[model samples]
Target: MENEQKTYRIDGFSCANCAKTFEKNVKNIKSVENAEVNFGASKITITGDATVQQIEKAGAFEKLKVVDKNQPKPEKQSFFKKHREVLISGLFMLLGFALIIINDGQNAITTGTFLISIIIGGYQMFWTGINNLSKLRFDMKTLMTIAVIGAALIGEWPEAAVVVVLFAVSESLERYSMEKARASIQSLMEIAPNTAVIKTPAGNKELPVEDVRIGDIMIIKPGDKLSMDGVIQSGSTNINQAAITGEALPAPKSAGDDVFAGTLNQSGYLEVEVTKNNEDTTLAKIIQLVEEAQQERAPAQHFVDQFAKYYTPAIMVAALLVAIIPPLLFGASWATWVYQGLAVLVVGCPCALVISTPIAIVSAIGNAANRGVLIKGGVYLETIGQSRTIAFDKTGTLTEGHPHVTDFMTYGDYDREAVLALSAALESKSEHPLAASILDFTESEDVEYSTIHIDDFKAETGKGITGTIDCKIYSIGKPENFDDADAYQSEGKTVMIIKENNTVIGLFAVIDPLRESSKAAIEKLHKMGSRTAMLTGDNEKTAGAIAGTLGIDTVYAGLMPEDKLDAIKNMQSDHKVTMVGDGINDAPALATADIGIAMGKGTDTALETADVALMGNDISQLPFTVNLSKRTLRIIKANITFSLVIKLIALLLVIPGWLTLWIAILSDIGATLIVALNGMRLLRVKE
Candidate 1:
């Protein structure tokens, strides 16, 4: 009486009363100890460990996520659930075989049992088939059901039984596999943190994200993430926003940067200035849009819907002809004609073919999720597979996005390495804006610098850095700060020019480098029948230099926010185009593309704007995702073809008396089973 207990996070809740209803239903468990639910939390906390499977079988969405007191992680798929669906279908197969072998060459029991199995295994499907047909439309299920039953009525027990069993098993496998595949996208909605910490003048507070409002100050400390859309009015650090921008490196952030919630602050501390509440946060919107887009459906899914509508009615008519015409028109014995008609019905069921497409797509979508690639659903999965062109945002998508000193042009009294040594010496002591520039130059080019002793140093923010190095005055500053306006061209990026003994030395250009994986990913995509293009607001020169370095096919330079969308539409008209960018200004373009892939390293809003979001900003996964989509689509088509051909040929043979009823039923079930296993092969497709 004091042992069992159960708990769950029940969603779509109406009220506490609804929770009570679930609690009451679950309390019936024999071993259950006690069930305690707090409606405010939307979760039931159980006292003792208990089996919750029975409750799950009571409803479709009522999943049993946890089985024990502590709410165990999702349980493994039950063994009973896996093989149990085949019971009725398997019985039909066994009955047809038994009738052929055990019953005398002409016995009533054999025929009766064969029909009984058909009735039992396919009764629901038979009713559904008729219902769909009665609506003046036919689908794959209707066709299969009509053929098998038509065969059975003609006394072809073997064919009738096999046809129904085959349809049943195939449909079951398709449902199971597709649902399993969709688990990936579903997982996104599952693991998202729903709560946020609210900051108040009276210390710190933990509250639900919904309770959070705009303009609230929140303390975002070490190891804590922003819970609402906010700005950094105070504090600074490097944030690893790979989940948003798909840029793996942590972006250095300071005051005034609009930081989003759900992005991890890898290091440093910040007092967040809240801009938007939970509803408007990047994560919520991304989840919402992805879901909406997934449900919108694609143009291709209609193909199957159309095929199923006509195919069913047409096949039923064929089965009727096979059963009734031969004896009436050709003088064949009633038993032989009926048996052959039965064979036709069994083999002609198109259940496998009908379900193959969605199952494969759903599975691929799910598979991408497992790899941290959030493909919205079958719709986006199919689009990605069909893409012939890919547009990449250069800043964070194709580059390291970490601004580092790359090339240094030297000028005066100091040799290249001497100027580097002198600058490193004086700049090392100052906490200035250009410190990263100096450090990057030394590390990247193997430039060795001896210590330049500094006696006097000074820095002016938005101006430049100056210091005494080894009894000499050395300074590296922007042109505007040096009172030397004509010394060098602006060169676009903030240029750092060196001046020693009042003479201009060298100018060093600083830019973030391309990611190690970007070049390889571009090459691989080219090999996979996709051309790569770059879209950036960067000027023609910088964009051109990067394009040449990476060998990208096209570059759209000086593009404003709105222009990106038009660019995407142009590419999309001829070849399916996939847009990859850091989410933000790229939202419209991402939405316009055939498939929008957002780098996880940026804003949640940006990630939400696309069809697919990468969790790891590694460019390598882009190739992997595209290839995975193609592979999944290929498998879906193959499975559909395989299932359809077997069913059609089997039905065709039955009318001509080439196939026995027993052979028809076995072939139908066997083909459906094989198609299912083949579709599952997608789960194994890897980069």
Candidate 2:
């Protein structure tokens, strides 16, 4: 049988290190050819004939769970059920302390209560620890279990009970913090409606989204959330697309306009024909991409993971040495050294450090996705943080892309209308982009022109066109092909010359205008210390005019696709370059740059090829994305540093005999909470 890959969501998968260990064990199973565990998303994927039973067996050592990805999540437990052991352990600890205070540490009840707390709180840890210890797999749980058991063996019952109770609380808080970090992504799942009203031949019928097929007409009322991607067939409305594209204002949608799933129809009643099914909707793609992006670890995260693999065992050795060497060689007090060893074990868990980078990455990516930007991975997000040079593609990126007739000049009393009509009549037969723009302009102006048959029509690729109308030969070519080309070229406009029997009749100057946001976005990039450049295939005059208008720092004009790619590479030699394009002709440059950002309106090839995508084709979001990335990286660094500093302080305390079991556990828990909350701050980043 061919090996098929299956993904399963693993319940109770809180520890990143434990997930790594589980993946290794699962991969060892005879039926499994490969296994990958995504600690951030709590998912495991396996290839070959690996059954859930085999997966469960692999993770059974740590009490990890394996469930099919298609299965709905189990119902949440009540508060008591969720933290039964912790609450029970806490009560026992309190009773023990109370008895100790009441009886002055002399009663059997005090000792019994402490012993009960240790048994209740530490049993789960003890079982898993012993299992892993037997297999020589030492982890945080194993360290805590040893600390508690060793303290008890030395007659420190109260201390052991306190360690057990505190450890339980720490585990609970860690799980809660991770859940908080993941909540951003979980919220995205609720955006799309589960049921949609479909228009049938007889009437409209409400059906599950899965049952809705392509080409089905959907009837949407005011305030109805769109259930699938479709085009408006009739009626007009304003749609709140903030959920998908993050456009702040509701977009006005009319006939033939496309509406995405998960956006609300805010104003009017409408009928839309579904263009895609539920699974293929834009909202579905965003969710999947966001989840997958979170799963790919960052460079810093990989380093921490590799460091942690050895960190635990090394700590174990150090703790053992601290317990035995001082007592044996230095003749130090056995109890003192042993207590210090237990403290070291408590400080060695690595929970905060393991999670420091991933939490920030997940939060930043989720926040970016929610704000109409899709960053593909942590590495690219990090790359954006360090970028210093931004190179923009001129047409369709920095400019409106649709050229218009800016100036029309007529010679010898020939009216502008006459020249325009003749040019439109000749250009109507062409399928060029410029031709479409001309047709649109003429149609919008309601220009009247006679359609006359022209024979012997010929188009030159770089110069212009030639045709014979009514036995009269007319040539329309570049301004340089006529006499007044430089005057139009000086104004940064593309000039076309029209002649009657080889005598110049008139000229038209067409130009693609700058986008409204181009100037502001470039200014923001410059303020952020990014040098801006415009790369275009247009003439130097046109490119320079745009660069001057937009205040771009540099310009590379008259370049082909290959030249653009080469320019990107040359720029990368000194500075980290970011290339922004519509993602079609700029494919090679986008690939060659350190990072590529594609506009949402670009072709699918562009969106697929670029590292980041700006939805709604808004360049204004680019500066915000850069700031967000920098902020995210800063937070991640702060988290890692904070974790290390806390651990370092705790370790130093072992020298002064000031590190207590409760203090050690609290420090680790405190660092974990701080980092998680700090990472979650990314969700609130704004312009």
Candidate 3:
């Protein structure tokens, strides 16, 4: 999450205006949690669940990539920067002391030094308070601004100078703490790789990835960052997509495999046909999502954001009460309360509450990323914990997308390879997962395949293939394609029986087996007071069997994309529906559900569509992260309430003259320290 107070580089930063403009630009990005542009360095680090697509659409950066390279870092002001204003005022105080030693307080040196110090430190307060007073904004700043000026007007210049300088120091410390809390979020820039070598027809040309565009042919050497989203057109390679999808195994790819923009090309050379425009590439989409996530406030966290808005103004009125009512009521000195009020005002800023929740969120997101999960934003974190319904894509999500031989009903004593080989020969040129799987299995056994009339063959979405073989009507498809009365499956996927001439052959079965941890995950979620359901495009038997085995509460099988979404909407009233899937076809359901949990190693579109990507294909972490979110929300609420209570108590004590400057400082700042320390506990959260 981008923390507004967090430091980031302002590209080509020339002055204060540039910093402000860059900050504003970054903030305008939908999911940008916060944008703090340091004018010193020409770089921008944006934090959020903003994907590259949104950013490219927003057009914020003419060209902005995260900057964490070992360039010579710029040197900011030393520890003495915040103390400079105080140092000048202190010099005046010392001058006044010299004058006092010579001829007493009435001397010109003493008078001049006192006047100078007061003017230097109290001017900002005077005008700011006047501004606030004009707005009918009876705030702490208004009271202190008037009080400090009054102190100087009455010849208490030294005291006035000390007050403002102290306030300045406290503000400085608050800023520093904020900087520390936002450190981890800055690491998000690493999501974009620095370089890319585009492949032109002439040869491989090395260029920065920023210059890449859509439809450009690119050659990837061994161990190269995939610079743009494209499909592999040539060469065989095993790519490590772990960073993008969190899978441990290297997926083998040949021609026609789509690779994402930010992933790694692990082994072998490859030529890719760019499928996505450069601006709308996968990497860009990730950045955009992160940014959006950061800007989106969690329901529980919003309380803190609003708390600071009122707390500051109320403290001002309380300060006035300390100055006015206390003197009138108890005949106590007005000066005492005035000083305490100033201290209260300084401590009352909502810096602590503002910093707490977002830090935890950013830390949690980072932690998830390290383990291969991509939680787009805090709002998703909030919803994930409450989601009760789980929708899944049959292939790649529950069952492996890679096809398998599920049945081999012998017809007239046909050999195993007899049907397998014939089907493989027909599907040898097909690109569908089941087709590829059949071909892979048959080819592995060195079964000879004779070319068939694949040109006439057509792939039916969610079903199977259809074509003529040897002048005989042949259809190889899901069991659902055949009459339900004619073919039936017990639990898992079953291939249908179709005749090449007349008599029926046998059925072949395949399944994308349940994720190794899915059953355990479902059980854990059930115990956590969440009802678990399954949504699939499989037949009644396969879906039902998987549901029963995993102890799922409900099952929706043989559903279309739209039907899945509509079913999710039906469950929306009483529960948050979490759709977990791993196919491009599941995109709509993923988008429609309360939480779109995408399997990381799924397709690029699925990865982008999902709200939370289970990075390693392990469904167990899904439940763990949800539980973590709930726990985090509780801690955040505690931090906010605790912070507010301390400040409120201190405010009461300040007006009644019961609390002094030291106690006020301790109360206001101590709560902040406590809140910040509590947020750091997120780093220790067990993943």
Worst 10 residues of 2 by lDDT: 600-609
What's model 2's lDDT at 660? 81
Question: What lDDT tens digits, residue by residue, belong to model 2 across residues 1-687?
Answer: 679998887877666766777898899998888988877677888898777778888888556787653557778999999889889988999988888888787467787898898888888789878877898988888898899888888787888888888878777776776677677776777888888999988898999998999999999999999999999999999999988777889999999999988999999999999999898888888877777888767788878878888999999998898888888998999998998898899888898998788878878888888888888888888999798899999878888878887777889977777667777777876654467666666677788765667788887654567888889887776655354666666676777778989788987778887889999999988888889988987667767777888999989987867889999988988889999998776888998999999888412453477999887788988999999988988998898899989998998998777888778888988887888789888878996
lDDT of 1 by residue, 565-684 (tens): 888988877788889887655778888888888887434654556778886767788988999888877777777677777776776666456887556656666775676677667767
Q: Where is model 1 poorest over a 10-residue stretch in terms of lDDT? A: 58-67
TM-score of each: 0.62, 0.91, 0.71
True-vs-predicted CA distance for residue 552, candidate 1, Å: 2.4
**TM-score of model 3 vs. true structure:** 0.71
**Per-residue lDDT of candidate 3, residues 250-295 (tens digit):** 8888899888776777788899987776557755655546555655
Candidate 3, poorest ten consecutive residues by summed lDDT: 10-19
Q: How much does each candidate deviate from the true structure in C-alpha RMSD?
A: 12.4, 3.3, 8.0
Which pairs of residues clash in candidate 2, taking residues 3 or more apart in a chain or in different chains? none
* Model 3 segments more than 4 A misplaced: 1-182, 190-206, 211-242, 246-281, 326-347, 410-495, 499-503, 523-529, 548-553, 615-621, 654-656
